[model samples]
Target: MFIRIDGKQVEVKKWDTVLSAARRAGIQIPSLCYHPALETAGACRVCIVEVFEKGWSERKQVTACEYKVQPDLEVYTRSESVLKTRRTTIDLLMARAPQNAALQALSKNVEYPQTIYPPVADAGDCVLCLLCTRACEQMGCNAISVSGRGDTRKIEPPYGANPDACIGCGACARICPTGCIALTETPATITIWGKVFERLHCVTCGAPMMSIAYRDYAVANRELPEDYYTQCQECKRKEVTARFAGLSMKVHHG
Candidate 1:
C-alpha cells in the first residue's frame, strides 16, 4: 500500500502503523511508550502526527504508534502543530523526571520550554513510564505495578509490600528507562525492590548467576529434567563443552 507522507509517497505493508511506515521512509518520530516487544500503550503523546483524508481537507492529530496506515493517507511528521505538542509533552516529562538524561537530551533536541512545574518529589526520578512494570509482566513475573493515581502514582508491589512472586530476575531494572529500580548482585545474594534473594553459583566456575527463586520459577513454567537443580549458566556451558570433547575423542579413536 502507498501513503503520502510529508508530500512524498511511501510504500507500506499490511498491518503497518503510521510510525513504522514513517520510519521505513527515513522519518524519526520520538516516542517513549512504544516498544516493539510490548503492546502499544500510546501513553506518550510525543509521537503525534497529523493525518489528512480525501473527503476531510482538515488535518487531525493522532499518535503514530497506534494509528494504522491507510491507502492514499496523508501524514505530516513535523508540522508546526506536531512540534508544539511534542515540546509540551517533553516539558511535562521533564518535570516528572528531571534527572533522566535521556529525557533531558530529548528536551534539548526538541527545544522544549523551561518546565513550569517542579520535579516530582519522592519518585526517585521515575517518570511513571510503565516500562519496568510492562517488562515484568512480559517476563511472567507481574511482580511490580503502578499504585495510586495521578500525582501519587508510583511503581511498587501489591499493597506496598514485598512480592512473594518476584524472582529477582532484574528484568524490571534492565528495562527501566529512568534507572529507578536499584539492583545489587553478589555471588550469594541479590537485592531488589527492598527484598533480598539467594543466588545460585556455577559448579565449575563458581560464578553467581540466576537466583534460586528464578530457577524454581523456570522449572515450574518450563520443561526440564526432574533431577535438574539450580545450576548456574557457566556450569551448563562447561557441561556442553565436556560432552562435545568426549564425542570428538570417540570419533578420533574410531
Candidate 2:
C-alpha cells in the first residue's frame, strides 16, 4: 500500500498502523498511550492523524496508533484537523495533570495553547493513560485496573488494596506518565526474596520483631496491607502477653 505522510510518499504494509508508518518515514507523532509492547487502546486520543483516500471526498481524523493503513491512503500527521484534535486532547490531559512534569513537557512539544477549562477537582493525578492497566493485564502482573467510571475512574489494585499476587516489580509505576501510582520502600510487612526485613519494636516486650508483623496483623484483622499498624517495644510486649494471660494481669501485673 502507498501512504503519504506529511506530503512524502512511502510504501506501507496493510496491517501497519498510521503511527508505525509515520515512524518508518521519519515523521514524529507525539503519543502517550501508544506503547510498542501494548495493544492500542485509543484512550488518550493524542495521536490523531488526518487520513484521506484517493476517492474519498472528506479527510478523516483517526488515531494513528489504532488506524490501519489502506491502499492509497494519504495520512497527514500535522494537518489542521489532526492538530486541532490533538491539541484538544492535550489540553484536556493537561487539565487533568497540571502539576505533572511529563504532561507539561508534552504540552510544550505539541505547542498547545492553553485555554480556561473547568477547575479540576481534588482528584488523584491519573490521566487514565492505561499504561498501568495494559501492563497489569498484558505483562502477567494483573495488579492494577481502572475502578469507577468517567471522571471518577482511578487505577486501583485489587479490592482497592495491594493485590496478593503483586510481586512489587514496580512496572506500573515505571510506565505511568502521570505520577499517579506512588511506589516507595516504606517498611513493607511482606517477606520474599531480595527483601530486607527491618525490626519494628514489639509493643509489649521492647524486643525487635519482623517488620512483616504489621502485615500479619492486617491479615488477621482482615484489613488492607496498605494500612499501618505500629507497636513500640513496651506496648507490643504487653499485647502479646495479654493474648495468653488475662488482660488485667498483663496490664496491672506488668
Candidate 3:
C-alpha cells in the first residue's frame, strides 16, 4: 500500500509503520522509545505526526512509530499542528531531562516555547522510555522493570528482589538512550544493577571481555561452547581462518 507523508506518496509494505516508511523514503522522524532490535514501546510519543484518514476531515495526532500505514492515509510530519505538538514535547522533555545530550542536540534546530512548568523533582537521568527494561526482557533477563505510579515511577529491580536474573551482559545499559543505565568495568569485574560480577578474561590474550556471568548465560542458552567463549573474538576469528587455510592446503596437495 501507499501513504502520503508530507505531500509525498511513499510505498509501504505489510505492517510498516509511518516511522519506518518515512525513514525508508529518506524522511527523518525523531523518536526515543523505538528500537528495531526490540519491540515497539510507544511510550515516548516524541514521533507524533498528524494523520488524515479516508473520511476524517480532521487530522488525528498519532505516534509515527506505532501508527501502521494504510492505503490512502495522509500523514503530515511537519504540519503546523505537528510542529507545535513536537516543539512542546521537546521542551517538556528538556525540562524533565535537562542534561540529556540528545535533547540538547535536538533543541539546536527546533524552536522551544520554554513552558514554565517546574522540572520534575528527582527526575534523574531517566525519561522513562522503558527501553532499558524492554531490552533486559528481550535479552531473557527480566532483571528490572518500571516501578511506582505517575510521578514516582522509576526503573529498578522489583522490590525486595535481588538482581539474580541479570547476567551482567549490560544489554540494558547499552540500549538505554538517556544513559540512565550504566555499567562500571574494572580489570577483574564489571558492576551494574547493584551487583559486581567477575570478568571473563580471554584465555588467549588475557584481555577482559564480558563478565563470567554473561559467558555462562551465552554458553548455556546461546548455543556457544565454554571453550569458544573463553577466547577473544579476534583470536577466535584468526584461529578459524588458519584452520580453513590448512584445510585448503591439504585439498590442493591431494
Candidate 4:
C-alpha cells in the first residue's frame, strides 16, 4: 500500500510501520524506543506525527513507530500541531530524567527552554522505555521487569536482587536506549544485575566469546554441536571462505 508522508507518496508493504515507511522515503521522524530487532513500542512519544485520514477535518496525533500504514493515510511529520505536541512530550521526558544524556542529546530537536515539571529523585537516564525488560524476555531469560508503580516504579530483577535466570548475555544492556542497565564485562568475567558469570572463550584463537551461561543455555535448548563454540565466529567465517575459494578454484581448473 501507498501512504502519503509529508505530501510524498511512499509505497509500503504489509507489517510496515509508518516510521519505517517514512524512514525509507527519506522523511525524518525521530524516535527513541523503537528498535527493528525488538517489538514495536510507543513508550517514548518522541516520534509523534499528525495524521490526516480521509474526511478528517483536523489532524490526529499518533506514534509513527506503532502506527500501521493505512490506505490514503496522510502523515505530517513536521506539522505545527505535531511539533507542539512533541515539544510537550519532550519536556516531560526531560523532566523524567533530568540529567539523562540521551534526553540531553534530544534537546536539540526543539526550542524548549526547560521542563516545568518537578524532577523525580534518583531518576537516571532510564526513560522507562521497557526495551531492556522486553529484550530480556525475548532472550528467554525473563529475568527482569518493572516493579512498583507511578513515581515509585523501577526496573529490577525479582525483589531488586541478583537474577538467577540471567545468563549475563548483555542483550538488555546492549539494547538499552538510555544506558539504564549496567553491564560490566572483562576477558574472563561478565557482570550484570548484581550477578557474575564466567566468560566463554574460543578454544582455537582463545578469543573471548559469550558468557558460559549463555552458551550452556543455547546448547541445551538447541542441542548445538559440542564443538560449536570451539572457534570464534571470525575464525569460522575465515575457514568457510577458504574452503569456498578452494572449491571455486577446483571447479575452474576442472
Per-residue CA lDDT of model 2 for 1-254, tens digit only, reads 68788889988988899999889888899888888888889999888888898789998888899998888788888877677777788888877766777777778866864635653676657889898889767746576777887667777876786476555545677788876676555443323223334445444344444445334544555555542344554575666788678664222212
- TM-scores of the candidates are 0.84, 0.70, 0.89, 0.92
State the lDDT of candidate 1 residue by residue for 22-79, as single tens digits.
8888988888777888878787787888998779869999999999888899999889
Window of ten residues with lowest summed lDDT in model 2:
188-197
Which candidate model has the greater TM-score, 2 or 3? 3
Off by over 4 Å in 4: 245-254
Error of 3 at 46 (Å): 0.1
Q: Is candidate 1 or candidate 3 better by lDDT?
A: 3
RMSD of each: 4.5, 13.8, 4.6, 4.9
| Per-residue C-alpha lDDT of model 4 across residues 1-254, encoded as one tens digit per residue | 88899999999988888899999988989888888988987988899998888888987899999998888899999888888888888888888797777777776676675777898777777888888988988888899988988877878999888898899999989998788788998998999999999988876567788988999998887889766776678877776887888842111110
The reply for model 3, stretches above 4 Å from the true place, is 113-115, 160-162, 247-254
- Tell me which residue pairs clash in candidate 1: none
Better of 1 and 4 by lDDT: 4
Compose the digit string of candidate 3's lDDT tens values, residues 1-254: 88999999899997999999999999988898899998898898889999999988799999999999989999998888888888888777777777788777665535663535577788887888899989899888899999988777889997936688988989899888888787999989999988999998766667789998888887898888667576678767776897888732111110
Q: Tell me how far candidate 2 lies from the true structure as C-alpha RMSD in angstroms.
A: 13.8
Off by over 4 Å in 1: 224-254
Model 1, residue 23: C-alpha shift (Å): 3.0
**Model 2 residue 62 distance off true place after TM-score fit, in angstroms:** 0.7
